[model samples]
Target: MWFSKFFILLSVWVMLSIEVESSTHWIVTESGLIQPRLNSPFDMERPYDLLAFLNQEKRWDAIFENYNDLMKHQKVIDALWFDVGEHTNSGTQILQDKDCEKAGNINAIDWHASILDDGSEKVPQEKYLFPSAYHGPSTDVPDCKRISSLTFSMFAFEHLESMMQRDNLSANPEYVLPELLTPIMTLDQFGHWVTGVLRENSSSWLHYHMASMFWRIRGNAPKALECSRRAVHYAPRAYKDIALGSLGVVLHRAGKSNDAIIVLSAAIDHDPTSFVNYFAIANAYSVIGEYNTSLKYYDDSLKLNPGMELLMRHKYGVMCQAKLSLRIKAIRETLNKLRDELNVYTQKQEAWTKLQTEFLKTIKNGEETIEKKAFERMSADNCA
Candidate 1:
């Protein structure tokens, strides 16, 4: 019983003896930009905390809150957030059936085949025309400066990029001008154009969904959440997953990982085939330290989008963290065993020391008795 108690105490002591190292996991460069660092080898797989980096910048809040401030600091914002030399239009294609209806008869067969490949509903061709204002400055002379549908779509995307500094542009081309006209428009003009488009297309869920992405990337969580909710309200039953996924991402960015997980789960239920939703949910789980669960979702996403290098990297990082955690656990157990052994050795040493002291005292008492007896014998002889 004593030995068991001693082992228990030794285990507790070993646990308490472990110390947590205090260290910073990021650094500020000469340009005043914060960058993440691997504080230890175990942290190599950790994800970059973008929200934390943005929070370190004093101007981010002001720029996100005020449109004028954001436009004034657009160059700085782009340098900080925008991908270098990457085209803004290279985003996920919106493959809704309604989008197929807009293409003319010449492209109808191709659109149908694409939709069919995705197992979505077949779309019927429909005639649609945009208001004259949506056209370029050459709207007055339509034949003189006629633009192809593809060029017009690219122009609208550029205008959206000018305002949002990201590719969160609405795929709908009914609310923007031609490429020839976008180059001459100022930042204020682009803002006004976006406002006008939103006002005119208040019922269009895709616009609100794109707007939510814009706000999300701009670090305006409240506005992003509001826009996401509006998008959910206006979105069709078939396309609700897009809005829900956006909401989940917004919540994750706002430091609400648990809430993000709940919303992302719902998004997955709505559209299980969307790899992006799975990836977002995986990230949410990762933030909350549910690495095993995160890995499962990451694998699910990889199955859907096999070519996603980014997802692969994230998964690899999480795996490394999981391995590190196991290693730490094994180390703690080893320390506990070593502590128990040391405690036993110390007790045996104390017992041996006590035995040696008792033996030495007995020898000293025997010597004292002999000396007393000798003195007594000498006294008797003197008396004779």
Candidate 2:
């Protein structure tokens, strides 16, 4: 009896220890951009990269079939980091999802969410979209420009990316344009923060530092160069970090690799770890073919949070031993191109069948949500 009692006490102690050891934390860059503070989720970070953060709970549920799998089995999972908002600090789209799945560490990051690989879903509906907005041009902008990037988690980011691309050409697009969406979440966060900083303090140095991010998001058309040049003159060491980093991104995007390096080096001197600073540095290095240095900074980034798969794929995606490419090789490939099957139902046939079934009771009772009843009736008759 005493042995069993002692064992019970020890088990309780161990459980407490596990919670204490793995408790989540919050992360805020120097600029005050907040994120969940999980350990290195990205395996590496590098230049000319992308980090796609999606809120796809359903696919995560499928990939991480058990709860333990969230923290322990990222090696088999890819796309959104499960502990992103739950245990770590960042949510919302961290970056675009292009080519993210092709990289190798998707499973690695997701699996590392837990030690035991408990891949079960205890949370509510996995496909629910988080209520949020994509960082837009400025706070002064109208709400429509502020993207409510609400997407069902049942569809992965990559799937959504494909949808966005396809729909962009459609007569009635269901979502925001990819061009606008990329900047706000991908690099727009930095630009918007800079604008806020400028409002708080109009130091010339700050303006100069913010120029590159402005141009990059704005697209590196020739007109953006003057904004960056003025930023250099207005540079104060305090604000130079922000200015140079932005300038570097703009220059790299404009295909001026050499200028990007010179500009970014000066910025890093002010302070590293500004919002996405190292990632931009890696981007500059990649443009100049300095993959090793890019890889070094990327490694530095991973030390802070290793699940930055977008950066990893971007910097090393072209390398012979790229993690993502290798993972693609290892996994069985499939055709992702979806078939759009449209079922046409005349009103007579549609209303006659579905309304008589799911909708009849729903309509009579008036208790069902309008959407629920409509979809049920529509589904029953294959009517829109």
lDDT of 1 at 268: 89
lDDT by residue for model 2 (178-213), tens: 233223344445445445544544433434333333
Off by over 4 Å in 1: 1-192, 332-384
lDDT of 2: 0.39
Models 1 onward score TM values of 0.42, 0.32
lDDT of 2 at 112: 7
Among all windows of 10 consecutive residues in model 2, the one with the lowest summed lDDT is: 111-120
Q: What is the overall TM-score of model 1 with all chains considered together?
A: 0.42
lDDT of each: 0.48, 0.39
Report the C-alpha lDDT of model 1 over 143-218, residue by residue, as the tens digit: 1011111122321222222223322422211122323223444323433444455665566555556555444434
Q: Tell me the alpha-carbon RMSD of every candidate.
A: 30.4, 35.2
